[model samples]
Target: MSKTTRATQALQQAGVPFTVHAYAYDPNAERIGLQAAEAMGVDPGGVLKTLMVLVDGKPACVVLPSDREVNLKKLAAALGGKTAQMMKPADAERITGYHVGGISPFGQKKRVPTLVEQSAFAHEEVFMNGGQRGLQVKLRPADAVSALGAQVAELI
Candidate 1:
């Protein structure tokens, strides 16, 4: 069998329902989540951004509200680690098998720990990068946690 892209293969195997939204890609963009929200005409707050962080020397995924920044102190406390810091871009790409702007919490090269902001659980559905830039996947936050085996925590 041939391997499919991370977004498609992971969602299909997990049986998680999701909708894909595609938009024009911009290479010079800074905040990918904001750009995606604007392109999709959705509130930026409803879109989530996936970040790679090193917790106790291990890479982990941290999902947070697009409108808010990750609180490293809180994330450290949640993970029971003394400190947490953003991973290097190259390291993130190598571990996630996706570029910086396209990293998703769903499928990764390695099954690193994942933590999502508790606030996201309040929304009925949320949008996140679909393992690629200019593409997003819409699904329930609960399903995301289930599919990724992520823990719910106050990451932002």
Candidate 2:
């Protein structure tokens, strides 16, 4: 597959330095993020997963470590909303204009409130989906946050 994607294009347009890494994507894998980490021979904590969610019935994007899970109540509070839930897969795909495993916060079809787990900044570099299956981008945490205009919070 071509390494170029909307996500990559967005990053480039923003002038954020990043490196793309391609790996074998297993659609059947139990956990897509972990699979990417293992395929790239990196720590799961350094591989972030992009998730679409509904906070107070509004679309939002969240990026967190592969080894962690989002606490709905915490996420809700972080977003200053009363409730939060995982967006339906079909809804997520429709709103983001990318498949579940390929969604990236940078280049979604719609701009929404986005958050990156504060802890992720602990890592010098992190990997996230590159708007395509089997593709990921490695970049500085601060760069990703700035590129997406995402708030850093305790999302996990």
Candidate 3:
């Protein structure tokens, strides 16, 4: 698979160091993130999933451990919003300029407030979608936080 992607380009532009990894993407998998972790032979917690959400009807991005689930109430509270809900797949794709399974927090068509799970900082590096299916970018969580201007919180 080609290593170049908007996500990778964004990282490069930001001067953030990262490594690109390619894995078999399974569209049929019940859980895409866990499937990625298993394919990469890495801990699930170190594989971050990018989610498109609407906080008070405004687009937002959320990054968290593959093995964890977001608590919408907690997420909304953390963002100082009254409600949070996952964006419809079509809307997510439209907003992020990526397919449902290939959305990455970086290089989205629209820049939105981003929230990253605080627990992700436990790892020296974590993997996230590289703006395409079958591709991942591994980078320091700190770098990602800075690059995305992401708020770190207990979103799980």
Candidate order by decreasing TM-score: 2, 3, 1
lDDT of 1 by residue, 10-87 (tens): 988999998887777577878888888888898888899999999878788999888889999899888889899999
Would you list the C-alpha lDDT of every candidate in the order shown?
0.86, 0.95, 0.94
The superposed Cα distance between candidate 2 and the true structure at residue 62, in angstroms, equals 0.5
lDDT by residue (28-104, candidate 2, tens digit) is 99899999999999999999999899999999999999999999999999989999999999999999999988988
Candidate 1 vs candidate 3, TM-score winner: 3
lDDT of model number 1: 0.86
Candidate 1: which pairs clash? none
Residues forming the 10-long window of minimal summed lDDT in candidate 2: 100-109
lDDT of 3 by residue, 1-156 (tens): 779988899999999999999999999998889999999999999999999999999999999999999999999999999999999999999999999889999999999999999999999999999999989999999999999999999998
Can you give the TM-score per candidate against the true fold? Answer: 0.94, 0.99, 0.98
Least lDDT summed over 10 consecutive residues: which range in candidate 1? 1-10
Model 3, stretches more than 4 Å misplaced? none
